[model samples]
Target: MFMTLTADSGADRAETWVERRRPALHPRRSWASPEPFVRRPTEHNSGEDVLGAMPWTRSASGYQRITVAIDVVVALAVVVAAAALGGAGWLTAGLLGLLATGTHVSFVAALRGYERHNLGDGPAEFQVVLRSAVVVAAVLMAVAFLTPVQVPREAVLVGLPALVTLACAGRYVHRRVLHASRARGQAMMRTIVVGSTVSVRDLVRDLGTAPHHGYLVIGTCLADVVDDEAAQVPLPTLGALSDIPQVVHDHAVQVVVVAGDALGGPALRRLSWALRRAGAELVVAPGLVEVAQERVTVHPTAGLSLLRLEIEPPRRRLMAKAVLDRVLGLVALVLLSPVIAAGALAVRLTSPGPAFYTQTRVGVDGREFRIWKLRSMYVDADRRRAELLDRSDRDGLMFKMAADPRITPVGRVLRRLSFDELPQFWNVVRGDMSLVGPRPPLREEVSAYHDAVHQRLNVKPGITGLWQVSGRSDLPWDESIRLDLRYVDNWSVTMDLMILWKTFRAVVGGAGAY
Candidate 1:
């Protein structure tokens, strides 16, 4: 028995996975259960199977290695460019460039910048490069001040930013390649989960949902759960705790993620020993969900381990973000005045309504603000909304329609390319919205929100957001909410900038645009 992992059936497998959505990875079948299978050295060659490079795709490890190479090359290029700009002698610059490169490589290694967990991770890569470059800059400044050898002011001023930018760009490209490869079922570790069925279910759902994390769950080692033998999970059950090593070797598993404590410390230790012998990596899940590694610090003391988590990002960063939003919004409104004017004109001429549409939307902390958009529908579109509710094909509290009868001819084009939302730049200027944040919900939607969902109200709503760029009207309601919640949890200036950059691509593509 074999089945595919689908997002819609994001629950306990049993019989549901077979009947629900049918898409993911390649169409190839994987074992649905373990049989009287034997392990032979010639039967399983990981290097020949998983690590073999197809003409179009490389292995995940190979991708990581290539990314490492790209980073060093970027560092060298940045150094050379900086030296050329600083008018330094070739020999002198070459020596300094090599030194800088060495420093960069050393810092990245210490930071685990090229680790599998960090590979294709844009924000992590960017943060590491920036912090490392800052340290490098400071070291140079201190050396110049103390010693007779003075570093070039031009290099310090230009090189740091250049190195950070180039390094981040390389990481972005690496992530892009990895994501594309993963979608095609390449560049992912053949992974297995070890835990109770319920605990493993959550982990599997999470990994399936975010396949870019690069773990492809092939089978699971489900520990004994009382009375759960009457239940069956969608995942292939390899065996109990005793059969782990054989299961790992037989399946050519590269990674084993231990979720919860179905296997206690001593048992887990023994399992780790088995995995080590099998040449597989082990990840013990802390059971903390959605926490960024940046917020975590692990320390070992007195034969014990402690994990510390910071509650939130610094207040100074949030303050700076507010300042940036207002400044950028003001500048954007001014720059996009002509485009706004043209869109308004189109709306006014094509529809029998005012060029602007305003609606009361809930913002940060349950506060309400009137959101503005270039009216893309008839004036009475709101009046006809109730009748169209039954036709909605989306999940959650959101409503959408691709063939919505209310939209005017001109409004259709504007909505698709997202030009209609340009007036919200003014909302961003008014501080009622932001350049990047959660999507503003209607009063009714906010009223229906669960307590946990209210976290979306922690920051001001946005003109564009994770929800908008994700799929706009076409996204399923739950995924939209997930993306928004994710934004609320992981908002950072760099993350915001990355979203904004992808926003351009999304708008142009009009993937889920209504």
Candidate 2:
């Protein structure tokens, strides 16, 4: 006969059943118990999960709060230092403090939003800094022009930009350092995943690939089964679902990722509640794959956790793009006019083509725009492209030839120094491109792109971008695409400036250039 063991106090009280089962079974007894075993019923409802009963651990939350507080304090200190160096009076110092505070608040808000809504994949450090800098710059400019404070116009113009730049650069360095520390196994959260073997294994694999998330999954709890096959799960199976509380207590788990579908409603509820009572943060990993966090929302309906996934609309920041491109582009063109003239003269004397080479390239949407570049190849370079196809050295939708014979003698020198790209400043001025964005693909290259690759066209192409300064032509096709997608997902003004700065160094170093 089969025996059905029922816990009366609800599933959460089921752990006591383990103790109860031990007593009823005599030592060396092999026969099954004929009578059904039932425990005394309690007030715990079926809807209550382990997460609900468990309180989030104070350690992780406390550290995050402390880190944020320190960031704010350091930012304020930097502002005070700036004021001291600038020799500003009380009003000026006050204004600088206000700007610094606003920047810190905005950055913290963006980071929190990214963590809560972005599903760990959001804008890069450069983009966040860019947005904050833009806001700070606008506020300082307004105060300089409108306020009666005796702040020097030059000081306002110079000091504000410098502070904004420094703040962003410093933040980027901090994030990089933090990530490096995490990679070295410092400042990490110990986590345990509770679910089926398959789902938990996959989640562990994904997490292992991204150490920057700072979650170290040290153990897995098999909630449903307890067979040898279940032991095949990648992580060490601490115990069954009933053993979660004990395992959590023993391992000092900071976070619990409960895969709900694998555990069933009742078991999951108990596990969640147990985790909460044990002071561990519960992170539910819904089976949704490849969905951006920005597209998901948590709506609590009655008592059930409702997850609503919304598709993001295509970006509609055209006015911002136009204003940024034209303003920065005009300034760049004016500043680099002498260099452009010299490049043009070199091209004219060295090659049988105009100083500037304008070609129709794919742009935002499916539109085509005439992109300008200083002549970096022979006049008949296009005619020679077909012959060089067999020598294509790169991958993906694009084609690259490492040693194309069509390049003019002087063109190689210009390309090395990125001098041939000087004329593209006019493209920026014409609003066909930005100072920073994805490199525009040739029309033929766009035609070869897969469906997902089309997302790169969501924003205007740039003169200098992640690809240019990162490794230029040296990066593999996959890496190039990854960097491009990263840029598109997290576009910001700060990133543009950072890329521009890097581009200058890259050009001077002549690394990874043709």
Candidate 3:
């Protein structure tokens, strides 16, 4: 049977005996004995464990509270502003303020629910707008019925849309600023690894590549069975598994990740108990390299954690893609009809080919589709592609030339402003593409892709996506694939709207267009 140490008076003696029996259990070269420290009884004795088990971190909880507070404040401010615009009356304003606050709280709750379900991040812009509009509409109808405020229904309608737009826009801006700040090393979580040196080293190396994830590896603890010299990972070897409780306390670690296949059931249970007492989250990294998060699930049975890994299918339903394409494409074509005509005329007058170009690109499940675009290159551009292959300016599976000779003067302006993509909005409406999705590949490009690369075809191709907004033609192929896969694993309507909004700004600025 395994020995257990309770968190009472006996802890100090037990810890001292363990330390004497195994000096190597303590951190490397630390002469101080582990006997001086005493483990505190858990707060669970006071019935606080229920609240403590809430999944959110302290920082995340604070953010949620601040967000709620801000929404309430904004709702109150809006009520005052509306009243000042001639909708004044204390009773009316108070009612409106209550309604607005209730709406804000409801939307915030919806957003939180979405996040909790891992459906995506935050509520979609359209959903929020729709909800806000319903509330405003009801308020206006009530006011119209209740009092002779002399407010124009049309004016209220127009002003309400703008207000909703501003609120959503402000949220988008705030989130972006927060994400940028976090990316640049603010508000990061301090993490420590508990495992064999090799596993910890590899995990650290993988996480180091994505600074946006906001993980800071402070140190690593080698398993008790492993020797001290095996700490080949770049992080300092803080101690062994037995010393985890002390290391966590000393470093104030927010997350303790156990890596490797070396940990047995008893050690894992002990580490989990220690982590619980220390008020730190415990994450275990199953040694599956390069497997996406969506593919892994944990099942606990009889005190043993069983990980289930399954391969995801590649084909998404064509019907949904088709419907999205047709509806959005038709709407886009209508809205941009004048620009499309002007662009077509410009291309026709300057270039010898048709104003619109068609190319057979690889579509879902290795099928082919004729993609539409405003012609941005000369008729013989394909013939010229080979001559410029050796002078390729971009790297990865795709080819990009910064200053291709095949682009006509009119094409250059269109490409720079992303006017060439206007026609693809029609494709989006036509069921041929999505407004935001994986970038469709050419037949030749698909032919060269390895098995893993085929995962890109899991979703319908999009006119603009992470690749388009990030750096467009400037990004390398491997990084593009990574972003594409990330989107596939975590696609959300909020993400799609965010990408579309960023695409507009990117196109206007003409950054990385070539």
Candidate 4:
């Protein structure tokens, strides 16, 4: 008979799993029983049968290989182009090209660019690629200056930038493809979450919202005392902390996430050893929510590794960001004037309303500002809002409807293509908003905000933010709030640029615009 493990004690509460192949010779043992419950060799318990239960997803190593190949190809292409432009001989160009490619790839590998864990996730991968390029360029310059070997100026001036740019573009395209596959549930790692029921439940919910991250939680292991919250979790309780290895083996789990104080240092170390033998990855949740990797630094002291999280970004960086926002905002407004004018004219001609719509939105520090947008709704849209409030497709203070009746025919196209938001560049230029920041909220939404939600007001609101590129109106209220808070706490210039780049793709795709 198969054994069913439970947190409760006593033989009477013990349960058996699967079919009863033979008679029970004695009462089943509890989880605390000293005698180990060993399973007999049966057709059902074979290694092949267990492994076949959940086959591994497309290996991350495969993508890593593809990334390496792309980088090498891009580096070589850049070298060839630079050599051709510089009129270098074949012998010298071929030698220098091979050397440049080797140096670039070597530096990237040294910086953990090809690490399976970092590939296709977060901004770390792109950061690593850029760092490698900078390092390679510096090294080439140093070698040329310090030694007799002459380095081509074009290689340093042209090749480095092109290589980094092309490499980053290639990696970004690959990441999009990976995300697309993951969205379809095609590429995902089978995972088991271990923690208290509450933590496990929260983790599962959060991970479920971002499936592109590629973790598929198949089951959970309750490490703390079983409580009422256990029933609320959707994943099956595979076993306790002690039975983690068995659960992993049975389910073919590729990743194990340990949340909360589920395991002590020694226990966690042992668990790591067990995972090593089992060929699985162990991830420990630091319990820091919405913290960016940049602000965190690991310090080893007194034989203990402590994570130091910076409270705020430096004032210098904040000043720089403000300048960047204003400059970019002004440039955007200047460059996109024709498009904005065309959109506004369309709105005015197609609907019986003003070309531009302005509304009061809460900005940094509870300040109110008039935000601009090309009119994307009928003249009486605001008046009709109350009647259609009950038909809202979204929950929370913010209101949205996939099939909103208030929008004009031309308005739908404008909203879908994000032409309606172009006029917000003026708000950015006016210093009332940011080029990239938290989502701008209406007065009604701001009034209903709780203490935690109010953290979003610490920075200026934006036309496109983490919320927009993430899912826009499709995102749930809590998820949107979490993203906004994350951005406010962990704001950086690099992060702003990344979000700005993603905004174009999000707007073009228009997946969640409505």
Say which candidate scores most in lDDT. Answer: 4
- Candidate 4 has its poorest 10 consecutive residues by lDDT at 14-23
Global local distance difference test of model 2 = 0.66
TM-score of model number 3: 0.73
Q: List residue ranges in candidate 1 displaced over 4 A.
A: 1-42, 45-61, 139-152, 225-231, 299-313
Q: Looking at candidate 2, what is the lDDT of residue 44?
A: 25
Compute the lDDT of residue 182 as modeled in candidate 1.
82
lDDT tens digits by residue: candidate 4, 1-514: 0112223333323221211111222233322333433433333245553433433334576788899999899988887678657777777667667877898899889988898678878888889888888877887778779987667889879988999899999999999998998898867888899877888889989899889889999888885335455577887787666677666665677899988766655456556767765557899886888888889887766655678899978999999999999999999999999999999899989989799999888999999989999999998998999999888988887789999989999999999899999999999999999999887888988889999999999999988898888888898999899889889999898889999988998987887997
**Tens-digit per-residue lDDT, 202-250, candidate 3:** 8888877765555678788776545545546777777776677667666
Encode model 2's per-residue lDDT on 1-514: one tens digit a residue. 0112233345534543432232111121111223221222223222223333322223334444544554466555555556656677766776676666666567656656233222222345435545655665566567767986544444445554665566555555655665776788765667888776778878888888788777888888764555574667767776655556555655666787876465444444444556555556667777876565555677766555567765443345546657778987898789989989998898898778688898999877767899888888988989888977878887765667778788888888888788888788888887788788888889888988888788889888888888878889888988888788877775555456668878888988998888
Least accurate stretch of 10 residues (summed lDDT) in model 3?
113-122
Better of 3 and 4 by TM-score: 4
Q: Write one digit per residue (lDDT tens) for candidate 1, span 170-267.
A: 77876788788788877777888877778888888788977777788987876663336415566777665445666676677788888876654434
Model 4: lDDT to the true structure: 0.80
**Candidate 3 CA-lDDT value:** 0.67
Clashes of 3: 8
Can you give the TM-score per candidate against the true fold? 0.82, 0.66, 0.73, 0.82
lDDT per prediction? 0.75, 0.66, 0.67, 0.80
